[model samples]
Target: MTIPKRMWWQNSSVYQIYPASFKDSNGDGVGDIPGIISELDYIQSIGVDVIWICPMYDSPQVDMGYDVRDYEDVYRPYGTVQDMEVLIEQTHARGMKIILDLVVNHTSDQHKWFLESRSSKNNPKRDWYIWRPARYVDGQRKPPNNWIGNFGGSCWEWDEHTQEYYLHLFCPEQPDLNWENSATRQAIYDSAMEFWLQRGVDGFRVDTVNMYSKGDMVDAPITDPKSEWQFAGFQYCNGPRMHEFLSEMNQVLQKYDAMTVGECPHTPDMAKVLKYVSRKEKQLNMVFQFDVVDIGQGPYKFQTTPFNWGLPQFKHAIETTQNLIRGNDGWTTVFLENHDQSRSVSRFTSDAPQHRVAGGKLLSLMMSALSGTMFIYQGQELGMVNFPMEWSMDEYKDVDSSNYYKMVADRSHNDPKEMHVAKTSLQHLARDHARVPMSWSDAPNAGFSAAKPWMRALDDAAICNAKQQQSDKSSVLSFWKRMLQLRKQYSDLFVFGEFDLLDKSNLEVFTFTKTWQNKKALVVLNFTAEEQKLVYPTEVRSQKSELLVSTLDTPASDKLAAYEGRIFMLES
Candidate 1:
């Protein structure tokens, strides 16, 4: 449960930008690498330390860049390798780090490796992909197992040339790699990924890192006969060879002085997270924890509207995650929104649009002040809310939502639409909700581009534009700037500070204390629509804690207002 070394990354604040939606330079409707480069000044101004980019690799775009045809090459839509190099240089020049998304769990069926593997049974690269003979029982065509794809069908994709089933946890075009092959592992470590590290890229944000090493023992008995992907995820995810492979990767990273962060599913067990990010082995620097992001959802197909999620659960998950981190090993990557989620304002607050500002500010202060690295997705700084567009069925790109509509919505003879509704609600909870394009200007296309956007930006781009927020002192952007600067300025209070949760009586507000030496800081946040108060702790109320940062114009004790948050500090 101890972090042996005090590395710089242990306390850095990271900002994530989904490249395709960040900014489009060429006015080609889709965003390019140059678009991101253009926004460098804006990002640097916000006081973020690291910029994590989702996959920009060349792909068929079938699953919206998840299916990478080339692991190393930048897609022409994103720009050339030279463009990325320029972005990396700009980031370093501005004193920020660059993080690349590594999708090593699977390769696009179009990848040269998969092409060769699928070419013939006798091909030298035949063993690189998982291929097995189809199962036959009672003269029926079936997958080798009852495993299902996240997209709703079988995990097995048929290969016409080889007369075999190739495994894919996602789209059929994305075939899972067989990590048992040592040669394949070496190739992944050596290929397109090494290109950036040699050029001084800071680190990697490993995508679906656990999927690479699956349990090799085949025909395992099902644990839950109801859910397919869950069974497969349990079987293959966090498998036998994961630690060995991650340790080897860590060895390479150790030589370069870079970092690696695995995208582990949002779970509460520190022991599970410690397996990959702990110091004894140091396989990864941290993991993206998805504790608070699980709230909010809706029904799908016949019904597709979000429902109210109680706020207490969100506070509980956050406290639970913080306690786990405080009680265990390694650091945590904390975030409220990202490329894959619906906007935070829409998720956390009630239906009142007016409360968005107070809500955003409250969320920012509470999350950033917590110990460990903080991740602020783009537009989060500007308080971007969810896209209010009435999305037609044709405009949707999310795989999970689309599949549920088709399977449980239409052909499946499932009883009622309860399961489909539940599936839709969960998809809404997934991070994809917030992945829409950033709104940089209120100009045509909201300054993201001069052309149409690939995905719609949030509905209120007029008010949420960076150009607008940058000028207003009371804007969400300003609040974020203040929060970020405070953290950087008061490292002792934020970076290495120990967290102690306040009494649980205030469910409408969350409070905590951070003490080091004689200095103390009390953090309080109001989560409900009504005003809330925190009775200061007996030990420090009179001596140490003082008002440090507050989202309220006046303390709730002074006036009754909804969505106010406060952070108080004690004199040394």
Candidate 2:
């Protein structure tokens, strides 16, 4: 375990805003930069030091904003370049930092580079993207390999005009860049520097950072015989030159006074992660791993199985990651919710009306007290739950969810029971679960827009929203504020402390401690909705404990109420 040196990001709290769902300002039923600007004060009031807005670059919205058509310009619907400039300035003025999404791994087919690459074989940009000749099999043309896209279906998309297949790890419209070419790498790196460095934007949250390079395009040995996607996924992720490419990008990032956190998924190994985020390696400052986040995934990573999980499994994942990164010069980000996953309150905690707030607080305290930077997704502070499971299939907007539904229906031969189970999985794990509009008020469109919202507002917006929570002292929002305040007050103990897992085999509660120098903080969390006692070891039971913070107003003797979490400063 490597201890991380003091850095700006280590002390900062990040709030991720899915731009389209955050707020729609122009009455176009879409959120924009101006809309984000309007909520700057509210974001600042929430105590997050940094705002990580999802990709807002010029795009056709094929994969939302991840499929970038123009790297230097902003999406017209969201705003113009000048609007982004103003937003940055406004964010700085309010003493908060803002980071844009860096999506260089792929570009929309409509992008000039892709268009030129596919225009003709001899075009100067032909080598800018991955393209291969079709392999004839049994007198029929087929893609060169069996690789599958992360979204669904084959990874290869045939281009009739060019008579070749261009690779896309995601949607067909989003083509992966050919990073093996020096010129292609140089162009992407230069564009990133010109756009953010000149505008004085804080940094970036790199999208699909690990898949820039690819291995030999051959059929992967099937590990999970039942899941072809899983077999192909092994070949498409964490390519051979990932480290070389990231190190080169870091060389450029190091010249600027900024930070970067790569969105590295499917990386279950610590060494693979440390290679990129280690300060000694000069790559990224941190990365978002999916060990705990992908807990209930089915055969393949994207396939969502039933929500069957336990405290022991959850504790092991978190503890193993913490132990691996501890003092190893590698840094990781702690989060329970993000744009690609369901809300924590809904998926990980008891969202029952009576226990919702406490459950949210328990999750929040567990996240904040972990030995890494804390990322809070929008509406999470308000204890937002998932969209009601009753919403028909038509109400969902995400391409991923729709694709998964079709795949499952086909596999199950349209069996009503199987389709119902698939729909339930979508309700619990779909990316859209976190894509609902930000609930700002009880007013129409949840005060997100005077016009109709692009998506329907949560039915319970009136009960759970920023307006209601900001006014209530015991709201999840308020508790989050206190957590951040304490984090700041005890930076040495919380941000730079050594983490040690306690009662590793405990099945009822998750317990751990963070110690720095002579100070120690013990955190105990009841994983279930029923009261449980923390079985403290003899050494800790003998020591004096001072309550620092808790999810419950009053402790019930030695028993912890459902979803209750407590932090006690130990007197050694």
Give each model's whole-structure lDDT: 0.75, 0.85
Q: How close is every model to the real structure, measured as TM-score? A: 0.92, 0.97
- Strongest candidate by lDDT: 2
**So what's the TM-score on candidate 2?**
0.97
Off by over 4 Å in 1: 1-4, 217-230, 266-268, 296-309, 327-329, 411-432, 537-544, 556-560
lDDT by residue (1-572, candidate 1, tens digit) is: 44356887777888887878888888888888898998889899999888988888899887778788987788898998889889999999999999888888888999999999999999989999899888888997667877766676778888878899999988998998888999998888887467778877888889887777767635545654655533455667787778899988888788888877777762446688777777776688887766676554322122344645555667667766566556456677668787767777777764256788888888888877877778888888877776543455445567765676566555556655665454545444544456667888778777787887887655567877899889888888999999999998887767767777775655566677776556678877777787655666565566655677788656655432577778776775
The weakest ten consecutive residues by lDDT in model 2 span 222-231
Report how far off residue 71 is in candidate 1 (Å): 2.0
Across residues 467-497, which tens digit of lDDT does each residue of candidate 2 receive?
Answer: 9899899999999999889888988888778
Deviation in Å, model 2, residue 25 alpha carbon:
1.3
Per-residue error for 544 in candidate 2, Å, reads 1.2
